[model samples]
Target: MKESIISVEGLSHKYSSSWAIQDIGFEINKTGILGLLGSNGAGKSTTMNIMCGVLNQTKGSVFINGIDLRKQPELAKKEIGFLPQQAPLYKELTVDEYLLHCGYLRQLDKRMIGKAVDEAKERCGLTHFSKRLIGNLSGGYQQRVGIAQAIIHKPLLVVLDEPTNGLDPNQIIEVRSLIKEIAEERAVIFSSHILSEVQLLCKEIRMIDQGKLVFSDTMDAFNNYVAAQSIRVEMDRPPAGEELLKIEGVTKVEFLTARSLKIYFDGDHEVTDRIIKTSVHHDWHLREIFFDKNSLDEIFAQLSNYTKSVN
Candidate 1:
């Protein structure tokens, strides 16, 4: 088994009377990106703060490479690099200058700061823009500078909060590629409201709603879970919901549009065959029929809505 680089157990936080997060726990045991997903006030920031040692959790513990965060704050933090939603940058400083300053702040030896700065710039594709002032660069380039600063000390884990929040489509693509490049040798924990971006970048996902974890699983497992329960059908003249429900394995039928239906059913391949046969028998002019697996966006909306209704 791979050793866990970071372990969070029973993590919780409260502000005065209201709780910000509750009993959050997870472990990163390998080099891969872990995505944190949630809505506007879903405690994503609180959780990241605790993990990065910005705010101590009201309860529970965090371990980075077997070192307790509370017991050895400096030692634990030495292995982490963090970039919040807003990239921290001094507009007047050049990329190289800022990275060198970061290396110094991390207490790197004076002799090693220049080499570390050069490597970080190379890794982030900032070597060409090394002498340009940060404020004069594009948003994508500035974000690269932020990431470069974060990794200047070569930390074992990097935490990023909404790294691609406000970029153009091209910039989003560029930054996403950069994130994958950085994750090649270390673990990355990032939070984003963009489901598609998370899907593209992360193998494992942790979704939170109302300060509570609602789902945590690998992307493949999540897709399989959705696929086992639903099927989508499109036809020129679709049958009634009542008629579709009468199919052998179907449990419910939802109309997406006049020509489309979403059918919920048991995980039986035969159900699909039955649906096709029924459409043919009715001369429904079937256009499409396939499993109605929920995308990560749909799943997030469903979970967040459920949390709101219950609360």
Candidate 2:
């Protein structure tokens, strides 16, 4: 079995009187990219802060690589690279200087600091802008610099909250690719409300709503979990609803647009094969026979709606 790099058990957080996050639990294995998805004020940032040791947990515990965050914060943090939603950059400092400073902050040897800074800059494609002050760089470049600072210490896990929050299409693509490259060795847990971004970057997803976990699974598993596969059959004029419902495993049938009937089936072998065999027997001129699967956004919306209804 793969070792879990980050573990949260019965974790909860409160601000004064109200709970920001309540009893959220999940784990990220090493070398995995887990997308932490939620709506605005859904406690994504609050959870990340607790994991990174920036804020104390109100209840329960978090362990990174078996090191308790609250017990040995410094040691636990050494295994983490955190990039918050806001890019924390010293505007006056050049990219190279800021990265070097980050290395020193991590207690790297003086002799190794320069080499580490260069490596981080190279990985983030900031080698050319090393001497440029962060304030002068474009927003995308500044974000790269921020990412460079985060990985200067070569931590075991990287936590980025909304890394691609506000960027142009090109910039977003660059950052997404950069994230993919960085996750080659270590685990990455990035929080985002953008469903498309999560779909593009993460192999596994953990969705939270109203401070509670709604779902956790791999991308394929998630799609399968919430998918409603409809077998759309095209014919000039087919019998109406009840005729199709007579078939085995056919749950519901609806007329979609013109000259098409979308039949909802169990998506099992027996049902799909039966549908095909039925079509052949009927000699219906089937223009199309395919499953219309749902996208990640659609799945998320369904889960969100269920959460609201339950609450």
What is candidate 2's lDDT per residue for 4-37, written digit by digit as tens?
Answer: 6999988899998889888889887768578999
lDDT of 1 by residue, 1-311 (tens): 55579999999999999999999999998887999988778999999989999998899999999989988999999999999988889989988888888998899999999999999999999899989999999999999999988888888999999999889999989989989988999999989987888889999989888898888899776555444478888899987899988899999999999998889997786998998898889898999988866777767777778777887
Superposed by TM-score, candidate 2 places the C-alpha of residue 47 at a distance from the truth, in angstroms, of 0.6
lDDT computed for candidate 2:
0.86
Q: What TM-score would each prediction reach against the true structure?
A: 0.87, 0.86
Candidate 1 regions with alpha-carbon error over 4 angstroms: 1-3, 227-230, 234-274, 283-288, 305-311
Candidate 2 regions exceeding 4 Å error are: 1-3, 236-284
- The Cα error of candidate 1 at residue 268, in Å, is 9.8
Residue 269 of model 2 has an lDDT of: 40
Per-candidate Cα lDDT values, in order, are: 0.88, 0.86
Give the Å shift of residue 159 in candidate 1. Answer: 0.4
For candidate 2, the per-residue lDDT at 52 reads 92
The collision pairs in model 2 are none
